[model samples]
Target: MRTLVSRLAVALLGLTLVAALAEPVPAQKRGGTLTIVRPTDPVSLEPNLETTAPGAWVYFNMLEGLLTLDEKMQIKPVLATSYEVMSPTKVRFKLRPGVKFHDGTPFNAAAVKFTYDRALHGTPPARWASLAGSLAGAEAVDDLTVDILTREPYGPILRTLAMYCMGIVSPAAVQRLGADFSRAPVGTGPFKFVEWKTNTHVIIERHADYWGDKALVDRVIFKVVPEEGARMIALQTGDADMVLFPSPAQLPALRRDPKYTVHETTGIRVVFVGMHAGLPPLDDVRVRQALLHAVDRQAILDNIMEGSAGPARGVLAPGVFGYKDMQLDRVYPFDRARARALLGKAGFTPGPDGIGGGQGAVPRVGHGVPAAPRQPAQPPSVHAGLGDVERGCRLLALRALPFEAGAAGRVEHVAV
Candidate 1:
C-alpha cells in the first residue's frame, strides 16, 4: 500500500511537472505546427525489424522497449518497472499497470514475449542483436509480468535494451497492421501517430493520457524538405518551428536574424565522406590524405558551415564511448605543397600538359572508378547505415535518438 501511495505521489508530481512545463509553452500553445527535418525515411515500424537510420530512433519514441535508459545515460526501468535476476541467464519483469497501445491492446507480459521473439527472428536483428537478445526467451509469468532468459552475461545488455531495436510492439497490432504498422505506430508514447504523407510530412499528436508527464507540445510535425537552404527558409517564414540538421552555411543567416534561433547539439554521429578505400588512386593512403588535405577544413567550417559543426576527430562522434580524436594523425596538414608532393610521389607529376604518371587512365581508386583499359570500373557500397520506456521508456528512446545522421543518403525507410 505504501509503495502504491509512493507511485501515486510520483504520478501526481509528474502531472504537476507537465503543467509547469506546458504553462509557458508559447509557441506550442499556439499549436500551429512543428516542421522537423529528419534525414532518410523509415523502412518499417515493426520495432524488432527496423533497419533504417530514422526508423530506429523514431520508432523507439513511438514504441516502448523492455529496458530503458535514464537522463544520465544509465539503463533504467521502462516497460518492466522492475526486474529480478533469478540467475545469470534468468530474469523477471514487473510490468507497469494500465498502459495500453494506441490500438487499445494491453502492454503486458505476453506482448513482451512476442516482441522479443520477433526481434530474434527478424531481418535487422544483426544490427541490434545485443540489445534485443539479452534475453534468450520470455515467458508471461502473469498478465502484468514476464520473465526473460539470457544466453550469456552480455555486458551491455541493459544499455542495448535501451535501443530502438528492443522497442516493444503489439501482437494484435502487428497482425492487423502488418507492414503498414510504421505508418501508424501504436506505442504507449506521449504522442500518438496521427498521419503521414510519404516524402511530404508526418504528424504526431500528443497523448494526453500518457503514462508519464504529458508532452508540452500539442503536436509534432516532421516536414520533409531536403535542401539545407529551404529548411531554414521555412523557419524564417514561420512555416516551421524547428530544423533538425541545418547545413553550416545557413548559420550566419540565422545568427543575423531575430525571429530564428539555432540550437546546436553535439551528438554521437560522425559526419564525414566515406571514400572507398579500394578505389584506385584513393586506394593509396597518400591519395586519401591528399584529397582530405586538399579540401580546406577550416574554409568549409568558415564558409559552408559557419563554424557550428563540431570538428570531427575520429569515425565516431563525440559522446560515444571509446571514441578517440585521431584527426591529426589521420588527416594530412593543410599544405598545398604537401598535397602536390604526395600526388607527384604516386608517379603523377603535373607536366606542362596537366597530366602525368606512366599509368593507364586516372586509376579509379574507390568504389566506382572509370574503367581503365586494364581494370574494371565499379563503385563500392560503403554507405549503410534504438528505445525505451514505459515512463522510463520514453526517456531512454528519445535520448538514444538524440544524434542526427544528417542528410546522408536518399530518403529510404531502413537506413541499415
Candidate 2:
C-alpha cells in the first residue's frame, strides 16, 4: 500500500500505525468517545443485507466472521479456531469455546449454521448471496464443530467466509427481533450496537464482556455528514475526531495542520469507464479502443485526482488476489490520431461540426461514476475530461447518467 500520513484519531492512531509499520507502538489511552464523520449513512446494519463500504465499516466494529484477512491478505481464524478442508466440496470448522454474542447467546456451531442458513434462505435474500453462490449449505456436526458444504470445489471459500457478510449473528436475537434485527444488530465483536438514528448517526459502545481484546474507546459515533466541507468542519471544530474520504484537494491543507492527521493508502478500488458492449457502436472493439486512446488517464490521475490514485492496469487493483499487470506487454497510449483512424476504419466519417456519422451517428454513451461527498467537484472535472474526449474524437458522445445518492448497485451495470 502507498504511504500516507496518519488520518485516525489518537485512539485508533496506534492501531493504524502498527498495521502500517508492522511494529510495536505505544499503548493507547482508553475511555473516550471517538467520533468518525462519514459522507453517507450505512444502508443497513445487517451484514447480509448491505454490501457497501459504509455498511461494512460499521459491521467491522460490531460483527465477527468465522475467518478474517490480515493486512497481508492472509486468512486468519476469528470465531472459528481452526478449519480443515476435508474434501473438494466440504470443509469443517472448530468453533471457539466460551464466546458469547452481545445478547448473551453462545457462539457455537449452531450460530454458524444459523448465520449461513439465514443468509442462504432468508425471506429477503442476502446481498452477499452473489459472493457465496457456490455454497450449498452449512451443517452443525456438534456444539463446537460445523461443516461448510459447497456445490463444487470452491477454492476461495475461506476468503469468502472472511468477508463481513458472513458475520455470525445470535440466532436467538434474530428470531426475537425478526425484521427489526437489521436496526438492532447483536454480534460477538469488541463493540455492541447502541443506536442508529437514520442519516444522523450510528453509535456503538465497547462490549464489556468481549471475548477478545477490549476496544480502547468507550464508544464510537459514526456521524453522517453528507457534505465534504461539513465533515471537514466537524473534524476541525472537534465535532468529529476522524473523517472518512476527505477531498484530495484538501489533503495538502490537512497534512500541514498538526491538530489533524491525514492517512492515505493504496486502495484496491478501480474506477474506470464501462461501456455497454451489447449495445450499438460500443459493440465494436475498435470504437471502445478509440475511446480509451482519446482519454489521457495519467493527466486525470495527476491533475484531477491530485495524485491520490495510481493508474489502474486492469479491473482489479494492486494487493488484491489474482491481480496481474495486464499492461506489462501492451499499453494503451493517449493518441488522438490513432483514435480517429480507428473510428474512420470502423465507418465513422467526420461531419461538418466534426462529429462522426456514417451508417448513423454514434449515440451518446451515458455513465454514472460514484463521487465522494468531499470530491463532488472532481467528478465534474472527470466528466468534463470524458466530454472533451467525445469532442476531440468527433466520433463518440459521452454524458453523465443521473443516479441517486448511495445507489451504488446501479453503477455496477455501467462498468467497462
Best by lDDT: 2
Instruction: Please provide, for model 1 over 265-359, each residue's C-alpha lDDT reduced to its tens digit, 9 standing for 90 to 100.
Output: 35444444455565455567775555445544444434333444445566654455455777643455456667656665665554444434444
Which lDDT tens digits does candidate 2 get at residues 1-416? 11222222110000111101111235667898988888778778988877767788797888899899887878899998998899999999999999999999899988888888888887776878887859977899999999999999998888888886788999999999988998888999999999999988999999999998999999999889877678767766667767675555666765665544444566555655566787666788887777667666666556655545666666665567787776711466777777777777887767777664675564345444433332333344434544544453221222222332113433222322
Off by over 4 Å in 1: 1-58, 68-72, 83-93, 123-152, 256-262, 272-296, 327-363, 366-416
Which ranges of candidate 2 are over 4 A from the true structure? 1-27, 257-263, 328-330, 374-383, 389-413
For all candidates in order, the CA lDDT equals: 0.52, 0.69
Give model 2's TM-score versus the native structure.
Answer: 0.83
Global lDDT of model 2: 0.69
Model 1: per-residue Cα lDDT at residue 261: 36
Q: Quick one: best TM-score, which candidate?
A: 2
* Estimated TM-score for each candidate: 0.65, 0.83
RMSD of 1: 13.4
Clash counts per candidate, in order, are 26, 1
